[model samples]
Target: MKNSSRRRVRPASIASLRRVHSHGGTNNQKQRSLSTGRIGFFALLFVALYWVKLGFGGSLSTSSKAANSLGSSAPRRNRAHLSYDAEEQVAKHKLLPEEAQIIRTARSLSPVTYDKVAMSFFVMYGRFLLPFYERRPDMKVLNIGLGCEEDISARLLRKLLPKANLWEAEERVTCVGSEIEGLHSLTGDQGDVQVLDSWIEKSGGMFDVIIDDGKRHHNCQVLTSFEKLWPQLTPGGLYFFEDLHLGKSDDHRSYSTPACDGSSFVFSDHIKNWLDDIIYQGGYNSKKWELHYVFCQAGGCAVAKEPPGTIYNKPPSPNQFDKKQMLPGEYHFVTTAETFDPVTDKVTTHSFFTMYGRFLLPYYQRKPRMKMLEIGLGCDMNYGPGASVSLWKNLFPSAELWEAEYDGECVEKAVKEGKLDGLNPLVGDQGNNATLDSWIEKSGGQFDVVIDDGGHHNCQIKASFDKLWPQLLPGGLYFIEDISGKSKPEHLIDCVWPILCTHDLHHSGQVEGL
Candidate 1:
């Protein structure tokens, strides 16, 4: 029943072997051998059946059932290493009208065939890019790779954005590499940072959109190129790196050449780390270009830089607040009567709150339970500290209101006088990140509206906006009051102009107004 030597035997052939006592052996021994053979045969049969059930060894019915379990109607291709489920990802995201038009335009470009469906790079363009182009039809665009045959991206941008200043950088313009007619073509290897820097110098201005469709397998080149070229991208600009799947895994090292080390650094890992640092370090707090968004998918990744300032355009609600609802009511002034009207009941108020009310009141009907954060407590003269807080509470009683002031004593005094009831004010400096973080933590992390009415100094106003703008909820309102009285004129021009002037040139669909 057992062999002394560890020799292999096929499961099918095991049954054909001679029984231990079958060759004229005793009856008892023969009977035992027969029993063992029968047991071994049944054991082999069970394993074969189990293998068939698992859709192995040509079990068509079982294989079909296994395929159906994956929730795909079409036959599945081997996509084991992909970062996303193709069908599921495609199903959830619908292309916008402008995005769809971008794909159609790319496909219409002759000779070079693009991916027909979910695999199209132009689809990604439509999702992340169309907004910028739609906002600024005359924006500058740079495509890094001009294909040997027809250049789809170059041709497509030329067709869709007729007024856009389009440029293409080709490694070679030999017989194989054909240059397009309308776009500005620069000859240089994109792997060289000098080449990219020179392109910037020759182009004369910063690009609003940059596409890297060159040398997909060169990981180090891509990273180095990004570092050099990023500074040249305009504020609120976008940079797209295509064919990321090529360098997403370690095995891609096989594709590396002597000049490029693909596996020495992973492109996706670097992008992820950069994004994490940008968020954790309050990167937007600086005036320098900072990462706003990093979107990675199965094919490639797109990075968007933060603008110096944010311009939000809250949509006009059909059920807007009436004049009576937004009108400022009576407040107990420390100097005047105990209860006197600020605006509607009497014309004795010195404030811009009435003007701001027109733009702010619509939010009440939009989000009745909206949360608002104001940087200044205004707790000094007359109706000190929590004075503005009282106004907000009166306007949107159902909303969660918060105020941050530099003076803790002013807040304590306001509370002692029963000025701040049903509220907990934050006492900290707006210029400090620690104070901003403390306010963020105490106020449930995010806000629907942020008002900078604090010091009104250049640095104070900028720091508050940079730190808080990222935390503001989508479609949220961010207001910087008294810009005409900034600490320095250059501060307003250098910092405020980019945020306000570019209102008509980026994310314009959701941008209702400046």
Candidate 2:
């Protein structure tokens, strides 16, 4: 008892592990928080949009007089406009003594709030854009109508190239129509340019880079007027069009389902036509400024005027997935295996849904025998012959299939035609309780998989997922084909977070986890 041996010390409690170094891993209670944060993101998205809709009206009014020249007369070979004092404002932050001291102290402590709302997009923008800023001394930047539409693009550019002068346009009037405001607005029609010439004249010189995000309605005008903008750009500048998901400024909630009845994608058709006609219009010499590099995503696109300088010796890296993998099924459905028209099918579906299939293929391949449901029979006639329903049926033969569409007659025809082995379509609102109850009762009260390729409206997405996802068999997957700019309901996790933060452990509303 008197002998002193080294004692094993249990230094901390289980609660201490939970408290220290919080915010990562299983020990953190953040799973509950993240689950609620799901609801919070939707709250934030709707709040962000609602707040933007109600208050974010932008008009570009400047105190300076309108200049007829766009700094394109000739390249400046001198330091005539450079000032050390102005450069010190940003390049060398001459913060006041008190502010500098505060900043030094702030570096050692954890931030009270991480209100980094803009960091996500800024990270994405900078990924492909930093190279442009690096070569700025030899560049002239023109941001067409970026005045108020996307102030961040200009702000980012300014930060990236502090010394460079950038010319941006203020919307004075609608580009094509008799609309009072020059700002982009939601309208039934994609407005034509009525006063585009005025803005072009007022802008003065040509630009090396043009961002055509001025007004949503004027996308057509900007594409057609590339002849005007391209001349302004340096021999190898770029043209960017942001917020391409929205067809117009006014509409925030609809997307093109690219089934190609007759009309083409509004922006796609317009831009392609312009690209084809650019040679006839002139100034875009094919050999000199190759219209070579075009980059597009869910959000927008960037078209480069083949680089005159800074050539990369190495080829780009290989991609992880091929875009055309899902196209075969999509093509077969759209073409009815009849026309052999892969080109039209590719244009109609694009690669948007392929991303969903890419992620879901694993879950699907593993569970080929699970019961499945496909909502929204495309407008293929209203009786409900949706391409997704057809594709899923082919993908999973043994699995039972169910289809829902608003049009009962279309569903009846498909059922009569023995589509998916005579499985009669479940025709009703995908969001309705009665319809869901009837379907659940009819299909033994559960589905192993649910794919929401439905109306794609915000309300419909929320309603269908909220009401039905819990009915999914545990360990099953729910695949939703989401539009890039639009929010998906169950993205936070497979489960939609209960609005009430705390609930009874066994409440009837509670569902099994994914």
Candidate 3:
């Protein structure tokens, strides 16, 4: 019977017989039976184990491997597929060129390659928080120091919160400190604080955000933080202190050591004492303020707020103040006419108003129907792009634009050129309150945007603000360009603080009483 069955059974495939022989088969019949039973048992065990794993939520190696393969495949799938809608959106927003450039720059200067990890981290922090701030148009911002020529923070804020007003103050050193070169040129003339204060008081509002990016003098930090900064901040506004490591005395002395000349002014010990006094003694009210002392990899960060004070507090004196009058030589060039270069046919390099007018045209295109005003248009609005009357007409075709050129020649030239179509070029000096009042009256006291690119002098800015801020509609935006002059220790203490304090008062009152 076995022989007959064997004859009827098809011969085992070579592969199956090899496996059976490898198992050390006793006899052909026995080997077949044993092999079948063993295979069945192992299959049953595998099935049971797999069922157990699935039922108990355990992940098997094979399953994990399969998941990883899927994960790898996803990115490949995404790359293979292109969304036309995304491309269209990019093109429609005109975002590709700038966005790509920004991305390329960011990748090249990535934190991994950058040596200053702490600064990188802070920058990331600012980037992370910026979007939230951007959504709130009413939120005010203050940037204390204009660190380095390329201020990353300022650039970020400008891009993110294009409409939000940012008050940026940098400490001006009479002579550049040895620790950092190329800062002397950026310093504002001495006594700029007084001008800054005058401008702020005149402007009639306070900053929503404040940043300290100036020299790391303990006295400056203390005074600016406690007196100038805190008092000026709008309720719920933010103040950021950058390069806090400079606040250390040890580092201060080291910085001073490299100075061969007497121009070096080291204030590390003074900074330490000031910080110690505030931190230890609760110099800033604990109840009114929420202190965030973030010891980040980049540097020390301190965020503080007043409890419930009106923004109208008296301006605190900055520890350092310079009283020297600015000379015309200090101002590289002052233009009273909107002259064009014969070679390039572009506005002369020194023409501020012309540059402003040109810059504003494209911006106006992006945000159409927005009302804008140029304060202190010395000679045909020449600080930023919209300063040129011709540029302004082309930029805001459908919107109302106004230019306050103090000089008659530029205003008449702008009118003659037919560049002042929608622009109401008023003859007035920002220095004189009556002139500003008359100009505002002529324009009807309502503007959505105000640019104080005029009068790089601090006091002129203050005067313009006093005359113009009331005319700014609620949720309107204002800009004070070229305030690079507040770097002097004296100007910071005297002028800038006072103006900031006055604005604080206005902002506080608007928040509370209004």
lDDT of 3 by residue, 1-514 (tens): 0111111122232234325433211010001111221111111111111111111011222222222211211112121112122234334532222332333343343121121121322232332234225334555565545444455445544554566655554555433232322211223321244544643564344766555555443433334344434566665445554444444334332322212211233222223333222222221222333331111222333343432331222221221111111111111111111221111112232212222321232234334676888765445332322234443343346778887767777667656655455667777678577888787788887776677656544456566765676676533445554333323222232234223311111011111000
- All candidates: CA RMSD (Å): 28.3, 22.2, 33.8
The candidate maximizing lDDT is: 1
TM-score of each: 0.43, 0.32, 0.30
Per-candidate local distance difference test: 0.50, 0.39, 0.37
User: Which candidate should be chosen as best, given TM-score against the real structure?
Assistant: 1
Ranking by TM-score: 1, 2, 3
lDDT computed for candidate 2 = 0.39
User: Comparing 1 and 2 by TM-score, which wins?
Assistant: 1
Clashes of each: 2, 16, 68
- Candidate 1 stretches greater than 4 Å from native: 1-93, 116-120, 175-179, 249-261, 286-289, 310-514
